[model samples]
Target: MSDFKVFPFETEKQWLKGRMIGIGGSDASAVVGLNPYKSNIELFEEKIGRKIPKDISDKPCVIYGKKAEEYIRELFKLDYPEYQVSHHEYHILQSLEYPFMQASLDGELVDQDGRKGILEIKTTNILQSMQYEKWKDRIPDNYYIQVLHYLLVTGWQFVVLRAHLNTEWGGEKRTTVKHYFIERSDVEDDLKMLLEEEKKFWEYVESGRKPPLILPEI
Candidate 1:
């Protein structure tokens, strides 16, 4: 099991500073060029304090997700009564083995069998068919990378991702809720790969060298 320390912050400013101290789940995808929004070079600049991270808290989608996360996590608890869910207010988990690795979990889980897992809640607005396709039969690639990073940090046994997708079909508004479970055992190789990639990216941050621009395959 990975050893971790909980870092608590009382304000958003403190949280942002805490995040800069290490690589976060959201940053993991960018490290490997899987994140659709951010590039590895951008992440490196942010980590090294060369560039200010964009503040997305004002975005409507971000605002809604923040507000809905608690409700969604609660729903998961009701949906899976056999698993106990717990959360700590404004706390971040930092790995002891890799002090530069961290995770901000939505909720932590303990199953009836006492196996530990992670609960990740996501609220997304899908406006196009392409967006829906990302969730067709599996979780989105970036999200998959994200949960794996969490697994790497916490050494947890599994992760349960609850996604709430809002979309419009036939001119009618609709919502689709789904759960994707990832077991550490099933993706040990992936976790190892992600860790190596993240370690490489952190080296770039520490050395103040920008990573080469990596684009998604066409």
Candidate 2:
């Protein structure tokens, strides 16, 4: 089992600052070069407090996603009546064994059998969501990495991803809900590799060294 320490903060701004102190789930994606919007070099600059021109979270899509999180969680509850879903009071968790590893989960879920797992809520435009075949089996790579990071930090056996797809149909707004269950055992090797890469990245952050930028493949 992984040991973790909860760092409770009074405000979102404080939480954001706390995140900079350690690598969180979102940062995990970038560290591993899976995040399309950000690269490892960019993350390195942010961690080292080099003034970045723009905050990705301030982007319109990201802002809308955050705003729709609550509604997405409620949708999950309504769809999965057998499961007990609860929100976490503390948004930040740091691994006691690996201080550089941390997680900020959206919520928690208890199955009908009382098995506990982490909940990750997401919102995306219909076009993006529909680009995939089945969400239950497949999700964007960056999002998958994010969830895996959470599982690694929380020592959870599994994670439930609930996504809301927004679309406009015939002048009317439509929202569709999809959920997926990802087991840690299914991605153990990948997580192990991710941990190693994150350890190296943390070293750069701690040493005030910038990591090499990952160029796009031809």
Candidate 3:
């Protein structure tokens, strides 16, 4: 059994506060300097409540993504009927072993065989979807890291990433769903490295010290 606890938050504000108390799946990529949109320093500033606040609520992409999440989840269920999908009641989970490590899962999956796994739903535009090959074999690094972070917190053996592609083809709007399975063992080494980085990052949060900004290599 996993030492994971789920906390029910009454409001979005409370949920945000809970998220600030620990490192989350979305924050994992930023902690490792892999999120192109955010840097480790920015994440540090946000966590510490510095002057600069990064907000994504008004972003069209973010808004669309949020709106498409449930549709994507349903698509996954339709494609994999053998698996039972259940939404997290509170959605916020913490690892007892590393209380500072947290996860916000989109859904939980139980296969007919009684195996459990995590489900992550994503919405990407057609152009972005085309950049990757088969999703079952490959995924964007940032998304991959996010899933690994969730697995770390939940101690799940595997994760299913379901993505909805919103695009137009031949003068018609289309929504296509794709899914990928990620086994924890296949990325154990990578997760270990991320864990070390997260440990160091949390130290900065605890001490009110800022992590150095990572500049683009190019």
Winning candidate number (lDDT)? 1
Clashing pairs in 3: none
lDDT of 3 by residue, 57-148 (tens): 78998899877777778877887898899885445899999999998888899877787789998887665544545354677778888998
Clashes of 3: 0
- Per-residue lDDT tens digits for candidate 2, residues 1-218, read 44688888888888877887778888888898888777889888888889552667778889998888887788778888887888865479899889888988888888877777899988877655455453546887888889888877887778888888677767999877777888778999988988888999999999998888766342
- Give the per-residue Cα lDDT of candidate 1 at 133: 95
lDDT of 2 at 4: 86
lDDT of 1 by residue, 1-218 (tens): 44798999998788877887889999899999998888888888888888898988899999999999998888888889999999986788999999999999999999888999999999999988899899989999999999999999998899999999998778998889998988889999999899999988888888888889878765
Compared to the true structure, candidate 2 yields what TM-score? Answer: 0.88
Off by over 4 Å in 2: 56-58, 128-137, 216-218
Order the candidates by lDDT, highest first.
1, 3, 2
Model 2 backbone overlap count: 0
Per-candidate clashes come to 0, 0, 0
TM-score of each candidate? Answer: 0.96, 0.88, 0.88
RMSD of 2: 2.5
Q: For model 1, where is the 10-residue window of minimal lDDT?
A: 12-21
Give the runs in model 3 whose Cα sits over 4 Å from its true position: 128-137, 169-171, 216-218
